[model samples]
Target: MEESFMPKVSVIIPVFNVESYLAECLDSVIGQSFYDMEIICIDDCSTDNSLNILMAYAHRDSRVIILRNDCNRGLAFTRNVGLERASGDYILFVDSDDYIVKDLVGITINEIDSVDMVCFNYKKKDEIWNSGDEHIFKMKRGIYEAQEFFVDTVNNNSVVHSAWSKLYKREFLMQEDIRFITGILYEDIVFHFLCMMKAHKISCIPEQLYLYRVRNDSIMTKRVESKNITDYFRIACFIGQFYLEHSFDTRLEKAIEQYIQTVYHSFICNYRRYELANHGYILKEAIAEKRFAKIFGIVSGIENYYGRVQKKIEENIGLIKDGNSILVYGAGDIAKEVIETLNYYDVILEGVAVSDKSGNRKSLFGNKVREITEYLYKRDESLVILAVTYKFYPEIKLKLSELGFNHYLEIF
Candidate 1:
């Protein structure tokens, strides 16, 4: 097909009250090098200037099509509305607040070929970041068995939770009658989970391209109404139940257990959400009936296990106390984990190396933070702990070698 005659890709964005960043989000899509596409901006009855801003953009760009929710329909219903009106070969849902990479549309479509879904990496940011590599969340990619892509997403990666992060073949979704549930808070997740399960082929690339803005108020991450919390539990159970109803893959079961471990670890013991009691009761029932015993076996006492690991890392700091200095390789969660544990164990935290991403040279946990280069020049006998995510291990190790950082170790 000629460029102008090519089927337009419908980029669906569900709008709410994101006045501050709506223009940036729209600019990225409008400026996309890909010309044969339409922007479907759904105004979900915002109480702010969001709808007006979207209208302004629509007036400026003929390709921008605007839709309105009769009332404040949830994200799922908004997306379903976009899906219903999308007259394109492919459809993609992007959050009203988040913006895509500059080459996101072109690169994804080029690499997508004829796959049912094109998955790309996304980076989370409390502030805007130009380099996508600093805060990336990676997931498994490849062809999946012909189940609804949404079905596999529940235990692995909730597709609904990430509607804006991937591209969809619109025909595949509409032909399968995949639509989001109305009057629900987490409709995207439920609908996406249902959609992906029926997908035949999926592709993933590791390029960290999507920027997810974490608003300071964190309202998006905050707890919803009591009724919404109850709805969440029902949705959670329905997701797990759907996965169990489908197949006999032991690998899938093991993966499911890991997700449960993470959930129980966060909601049950750690974050200490008031949700603990109700969920804890269900957990106890599961243990009593031995229903998800395998999950329990894998996750039981994970807290204590982490505590022991922290203890061991502190013990390793014995070297630093014995006439050796220490360098911590990461400045984020894991580095903080090790630094805090060492201080708890009475090991003095001498120097902290913020990850090379920013080449930061300031205190993150305490007044001890400095650049790795600065730390190296300041001290000779320092042993560094490669306290970073496992995925970054190889590159960080190589970076260390280039910088002559030989005296280091990893927990794994």
Candidate 2:
């Protein structure tokens, strides 16, 4: 490509107290083989030494621009600063704590055709910065069109409403007035949908080339309040109306229909302990108004109409005896729920077992956390509560039986 023929991309990064991983993040953005882009770092009045480090970088390279916020505005506002100051044909958001693969820019840039956004698979990293992931995807027709991208991605299990993992056209983004929601968490969820709705052509590339670092201090991973759900649901409900008014398409509608359930369920599950005074009212309104789908998520995944069946099983499990010594079958959030419900009934949990081909095995519940393979062989045992959904039942049952387990049962 000739000098001016190459499309200019403005890579925007928002930083706030990500001092520990900022260096690595900067390296990736600055090290991009495609040098036509500018790396703009917006510091959201970080109290940490993040600004100092960014300034140090600015001194070294003219391409690295550092913008300081007058005060501690939230992520939405900081990202908008990046958006407002961006000077390229396309805009890309990279989180300060996350780093891109060496080939990420080179590959994503090739996808600048008939696409609103181009996305690649991402790897999860721990606070220590170690990477973790199973399967990654690469898809096309995920590039420019918003609603098409959302529908296809959700159906194929690849859509994640995160900003750090995608590239977007500046004109499309600006035209949509799609800025991150100020002060509120879960901005990506709503914003992504809106963008997709406004997109013309879409595409995707399935490559696990981005590293997403999981930090305890990050707002998303923190224990959320009941109001968090209220806020998220409210935005999602509005977006649903936005879609309806636009009259997008069946695929996008189906995608949102299934998605609303998971969103509501997440709200309910995250705030399971404290009753959201208006949780029921908000969800009922969302559902009754035909704003969202009834989510019946199976304990593990948001898939295959399993959420409904899982809800039915959960209703019955609540009626079971609490005094029973429970050995929960799964080690996920839902399994945690079974454990919690059992504890609510004053039942003693014996152990937890997890079976997944693509995950690291670690103890979650206080019960002697072990793999089903390891836990079932123990001669002295209690109820092996199959806390997992029916989909995984065959695999779990086969594994437990192979270990000569006879007391295996379901929480319901």
Candidate 3:
């Protein structure tokens, strides 16, 4: 631990009131199989014994560098402080309440030799550590050209944005000036997107190297609030501007459109969840933001397409009337709107169907929800309205075709 010798990796952990988990997190980092690294612990003026725990670690381990804020800065500011002080070759962000596997640093560093970033898997520390639901997108383990990788991953809906699951090259980050957006909840979204855009080479592996603690009180798990709604809109606006500032190749058009469309859909979903009398005003305010204009333009196009689909459904009302049973094949906000629209025409739906029940609503509009396969028997005589986003349309259509359910129409 000489002053002249630089470490290969700088492990940054931003701390708040996580004293109970701080020691365990530090132990995991200090006991890494890769020993040539510095652990930068930035404490954000915790009211608890978190600062004391960090001091104790710094006392025993010279590699543990502690920096304290004068006041309670948020996670983004604390992480920025660590990044400013980090002198290692690479950077790895670890939350204070989370712990990692012994070889996380070693394996990640080994994989990041020629790559600007190395993204691996992680396990959720629930009742038992499990990786079943950790990765929502399926990606192969290999090295890829970063721009093509970003375009394909975003296009195919096979990308992850969690900052903690990746190892980044310090020079690459510094060259691009990539840092978390201050005063935002989902800063990782913007941070990772910019890194993906600027990076030259990237690697992906299947090893579950990190353990993410899933607690009820965590910011991600907390109930949605007004800040969450407004902050997310602000993030969306930032991303929209980023897309416009960079006129990427025409081939990347679909990828960028997909990203914006997904963000807009989530914005609407969360806006709906936030029950308030001023919801329309919030919506208008978001639309009024000058930077958000591009994003809203994309949304407008999508809504216009759906508007045509709604008219077609209205014109083909006889199709639903001819069916022995009627069902909606999605459980998202669009599906709810579709159902409500159909109900306005006095059409009765038998049930709501989903490709999978996990992380989906069990019911919609007083209709029972079940797997799409469960409704296959009635498909011959039933009229199924496919109400999912178009990105998933081809796969769902293929599944329906494989299941021999031909009496269906997609409301893309």
Tens digits of lDDT, candidate 3, 209-293: 8888877567776777777877777777787888877888876756776676666665654565445456566677776775555
TM-score of each: 0.65, 0.76, 0.74
Clashing pairs in 3: none
Q: TM-score of predicted model 1?
A: 0.65
> RMSD, model 1, all Cα superposed?
7.7
lDDT of 2 by residue, 1-412 (tens): 2335343889899999988999999998888888887888999989889999999998887788899899989888899999999888888889888899888888887886667777667877665224343334525534445566667667765668898777888888888788887877788887777776677776677777788877767876665676676776666566656655665456766787766655655555544445466566754554455433433333433323333334544565644444244567776556756665555456656667666423432444345456656554463454577766678878877877777776665543
What lDDT does each candidate get? Answer: 0.65, 0.69, 0.80
lDDT of 1 by residue, 331-398 (tens): 75567667756655567656777545453323444434556777756445667787776788898788
TM-score of 2: 0.76
lDDT of 2: 0.69
Better candidate number, 1 or 2, judged by TM-score:
2
Which 10 successive residues of model 1 have the least lDDT summed?
Answer: 128-137
Which one is best on TM-score? Answer: 2
The clash numbers for all candidates, in the given order, read 13, 27, 0
The lDDT, on a scale of 0 to 1, for candidate 3 is: 0.80
